[model samples]
Target: MAFIERYSRRTRWFHAGIYVAVLVLLATGWWLALGREGRPSPLARVTGLADTTVHLWTGWGLAGLAGVAVTVGVRAAGTFLVESVRFRRGDLRWFVRWPAAVWTGRFASHDGHFDPGQRVANLVLTGCLAVLIGSGVGLAFIDGGIGFVVLRQIHRWATFALTPVVVGHIVIASGILPGYRGVARSMHGGRLRVETAKRVWPGWLHRTQNR
Candidate 1:
């Protein structure tokens, strides 16, 4: 029945802030893209700003937040980077067994803080976010040129690509799947029962304890 420490307060705060910003950006960006430039959704109504304005400011804010995280929460950022980059033996087996594990409450063991799937998720989400931020900034700063048009198109496609991946990540992290039940609490300074932790992330638990 023992529990292990998972996310730190700072880590959790940054995580929540970043995701909230991304969600806001997505809503505004998609609304503007689908509607006329002057038209805005209720999400835009609440913000009391034009959709493009909201999206632009939010993107800048996210970039600043990321900078702050890297500077102020350097330790946590480093740990996350190290963990996400790590790949170890048995990782391939973990991915191969992931489908059945989704409903079986049994996950294959592998090394490191992140499972193989999570490492892939980390890389993908990072790439998408980088593309989003880069293109968003370019679109916001540049005006009336082919470059701006190109950036806008890139941002559009990046949003299209990121949406489903983010949704899937949400589904998994929410622990709605049978195999991941009780796993949701591991984020945001929460913990999991020893058994639940072991079942879902045996390698992480082992590494955390041993380290």
Candidate 2:
């Protein structure tokens, strides 16, 4: 099968960085929020910090990386954002049929850059990241005022909300499910098989061919 570019080198790097940062943040955040009193976090055990220095730094790293991606890959980022939100013909039907397909081991046809489920997931993930970043910034200023205490709660809740989204994304992208096998190689190597593209993203493939 032929191959088509699915992700650029810079985009791949950005995604990898975000994944690592999120994993670190989730681990440290969980320990800080739920660990037994007087017990050190795994990260704290390694770094010898009273608080979660790894979490704080990783949050900043995520924010910074997002900023850099917006600045350096503005066109690519804009294209992704636009495509992810735009509804297309058959998208609604795809959403309507998705649950049964999942249960029955069948799949519906979708002709968009992303199916309806993916579009909704992308929107939710984007919103969650925005909340995380905004509340994280406020948390950084927590020592200065009482308003930031509220922000701390908000940040914690946002992190908790993001956990499931992240887990689901990983599960799907890792191709553990029946229909998604080998899908993750696109992000790893920046290309996908033409057959896979035709099956999963016919609209995008059609557009590329037309161009």
Candidate 3:
């Protein structure tokens, strides 16, 4: 078995930061929403702050992470955006076999950086994050009015919609799924076994070797 670098250490750190902020925000947000607004939830208890305070601060921190991604990691962010949105000839075919592929470890042949499923996931996750941040910022400024009410509801619904997709992403990225074995290392360890690269992202591996 051979190993090759995938994500950079910087990229992995950014990924870690964004997800940590998001998870913290989600936990605190729910705690506050469930009628524990000023009370100390487990997180708040640990931090010695109120639930609402933790939720608000974490949301802003997430927004800050996004800003850094676009500004500091702009090139990487651009590459990811480009690779994720572009479609190729075999993409549709890849989707057809994906369900079975998840367990069978026999992914359909496709050419691209990210798989078709990942492309869809990227768009959905990005959109939801935008909504969550925007609504959260709005909620920060406007208090005790219809605008606040509307933003709260939008934030709630966006959270509702995003949770399942995030879970699926975690399941795959955790390498818990049969076909995604070793994939978690691409992010966590910033490398992949050559065979795992071929099975999961043939085009990306080929492109890397040729480059």
Candidate 4:
């Protein structure tokens, strides 16, 4: 039997907001980046603004939201990161055995608050967001008496650098993970099934028994 606990409602709200903001920023950003110069984007035209302005404002909004989300995610995910990912002999064993476990659906045998794959995903996202945010800030400040041409180049390069990670994140979150429904529910309801907690996190049950 799986144990159940609810994620914080506030956390879920922030997560959902960030997801919406990021997706909007990314879509509008692409139009602004790839659309022909002087030809207003169809999407921007529909939205009744120039695509470039939409992209700029939305990018700023996404950056702010991401900062908030990262602060919260770091705190929420810290425990699993430290305990489950510390260099342990058994961690290597689990890493080596992960493929077979996946094929056989034996996630329980390799125990932790988060599976190794989940840990990897977390790291990827954390690192990518760091880069994205840093680059965004640098890009934003490049044009205010810092030289327009240089700043524009820096902004372009930063955008190029961030694209691959963004694509990879989308693919893994939407296409690859088995816990998509649970993840969706976590965002929607701020709660997960007891079965999920049991399968992925036997430890939490013990710790949260009093609460």
Highest TM-score scorer: 3
Candidate 2 per-residue lDDT, tens place, 68-130, comes to 868987887788788788887767777777766544434577666776677777888888888
- Local distance difference test, per candidate? 0.83, 0.78, 0.88, 0.59
Strongest candidate by lDDT: 3
Question: In what order do the candidates fall by lDDT, top score first?
Answer: 3, 1, 2, 4
User: How many clashing pairs does model 3 include?
Assistant: 0
Of the two candidates 3 and 4, the one with more favorable TM-score, higher being better, is: 3
Q: What TM-score quantifies how close candidate 3 is to the native fold?
A: 0.95
What is the per-residue lDDT of model 4 for residues 16-79, given as tens digits with 9 covering 90 to 100? 7767766666666666567564777766778888766776677777777766645866676566
For candidate 4, the per-residue lDDT at 165 reads 61
Per-residue accuracy of model 1 over 1-211 as CA lDDT, tens digit each: 6888777776677788998998988788778778766876787788788877888888899999878867987887788878898887768889899999999977788766777888888888888888988887787789868998898889889899888888888899888999988877887447677787788778778878889
Q: Candidate 4: which stretches are off by over 4 Å?
A: 1-3, 33-43, 66-87, 97-104, 108-112, 144-181
Model 3, 12-50: lDDT tens digits are: 998999899888987887777677776688898899987
Worst 10 residues of 2 by lDDT: 98-107
- Clashing residue pair totals per candidate (backbone < 3 A): 0, 0, 0, 0
TM-score of each: 0.93, 0.89, 0.95, 0.68
Model 4 C-alpha lDDT versus the unseen true structure:
0.59
lDDT of 1 at 171: 94
